[model samples]
Target: MALNLNDLQIFVQAVDSGGFAAAARRLGMPKSTISKRVAALEADLETRLLHRTSRSFMLTDPGRDFYEHALAALIEAEAAESAVRQRHAEPSGIVRITASVPAAQFFLSDHLPSLAVAYPKLTLQLHATDRFVDLVQEGFDIAVRNHFAPLPDSELLQRQVSIDEVILVAAPSYLEKHGFPADPRDLKNHAGLLVSQTAKAWRLHHVDQGTISVSPHCRFIADETLVLLRAAASGLGIACLPETGCKAAMEHGQIVRVLPGWTAGTVATSILTTHRRGQLPGVRAVVEFLAKGFQAERAATGNVLEPLRETTEARS
Candidate 1:
């Protein structure tokens, strides 16, 4: 038999309020409606739940038993509702995130300390890899991707975080020994610390809005950014790296910019997710935090080359 939940609620309220009249006052309904609902509930259960008379109102033994269980169920239901509402208000849970090694190291890692302080209840699990991750299949909450070209269409919602400029850098000693490139084509003669050995071409964009593509001679090859950074700093060859990754080394004079007026390219860094909006509070908090942090990082790193630029100009 299908139990009438409304009648069940009225029956419990009538017991607690001491009478049908008082329950009607509390529930803002007429006493006759309150009495009828409890009667309907008794009929549905095929049990006499109340002894009603002109002066006295009382409960049957079965009515007392049912009242206890019904009241407990009602309380549990209310608590569940409150808990769900709290999730929307607070960011508290594990948010699994994925990104490339360099992105996780240089960009994403920088924001974690502050993110922890801001959202104490949020826990982050980072998966750092260069391979593409299927967010849905892999059960990831967020993914930061670096795109060298326009991002391909996908089921994931993509939000552009920042544009990272790719530039050529090498140790000062390497540049001194091999000599700096005076023009874009001159890069062909220079040894390159490349991510891949497959005769890669570096497409350079100049300050004067000019563009050129040159295939550098690969001297050292590594798919990892940190490896390439170390090779360049050790005076192995000129390495093309994101400006954000090169910022500290340039400031420390470990490496200097090559062909100062040109850049290899600009990469778009984006945040990918399963939903465009209305994400879990923890996930939304993380996304917004990273987006703001990357923008600030890009702005701060923009001038890291100024000192190097001046030093290089003096030598030329």
Candidate 2:
């Protein structure tokens, strides 16, 4: 019996992805359909393709040989399809992305919906989290992150799209109650809403002068930046926040800048990917847009670029 091409394709996905269920997920097909297709492939070939175990799939010798052959054929088939698509397709494909909460709200939320409007054919899937996202395993096309430095690994190709200033800000009322310290040194006495994860020690930089390292004796630790921003705005305490996260409140007079001259460690937000040259049209478009988008907004807030190059290099 001759094997159907589609069945063979399903078999390849099953083998590559390690199971029928995983293949179904990757192919966006039903698990039952994937299982049935693989079974049909086995019957057509007159041999059992996989030796099943409790938690793993093992290929028989013939199955292994067939897998190699079928995988090559699948690659050729994909290339052919891609070539045809390249000629006729618009920028229409699933673009899976990941981003931090602050970056997502401040940077992407408005832009992404607008992007969908511009490219009606394109489908965008966004995954937002404060914790690290593994691009390969999570199947993410792009990751927007707060980059005080380079990506943890060199495998990810990253571009500096936005510069988010880490600044000391507090509610005007809070300052009134606690009394504004004449300098950065007095911050130790105030109720500091410290970001427990990202900022451990504060690096404050003066425009004309230099960097001053300050570590506040915090009364409370905010697990997330939003919590930190809200608390600071509500006059609970002072916080070191990225300018984008606080820009809206800052502009509306909800929160006021605490230390005008002192700058905390400003992080450079980056778009990360595995593609070295950034070949994907969607990825390229977003990256270019972010690069220009954030840079232009710098004038409104004095978020000047301070290259965390030393940090990135050290990590790499």
* TM-score of every candidate: 0.69, 0.64
- Candidate 2 stretches with Cα past 4 Å from truth are 1-89, 197-201, 207-209, 215-217, 302-316
Candidate 2, residue 202: how far the Cα is off, in Å: 3.2
Best by lDDT: 1
Q: What's the lDDT for candidate 1? A: 0.82
Q: lDDT values of the candidates?
A: 0.82, 0.76
The per-residue C-alpha lDDT of model 2 at residue 22 equals 90
* Model 2 RMSD, rounded to 1 decimal: 14.1
The positional error of residue 117 in candidate 2, measured at the CA in angstroms, is 1.1
Model 1: per-residue lDDT, tens digit, 1-316? 8776677789899998889999999999999999888877888789998888988889899988999988888888788888688666878889888898888888878887789889999898999988878888888988887777876676667777777789899999999999988887998899988888674888889879699889888799998888899999999999999888999899999999988879987776778877633267788888888887887786686632311110111100
Please state the error at residue 247 of candidate 2 in Å: 0.7
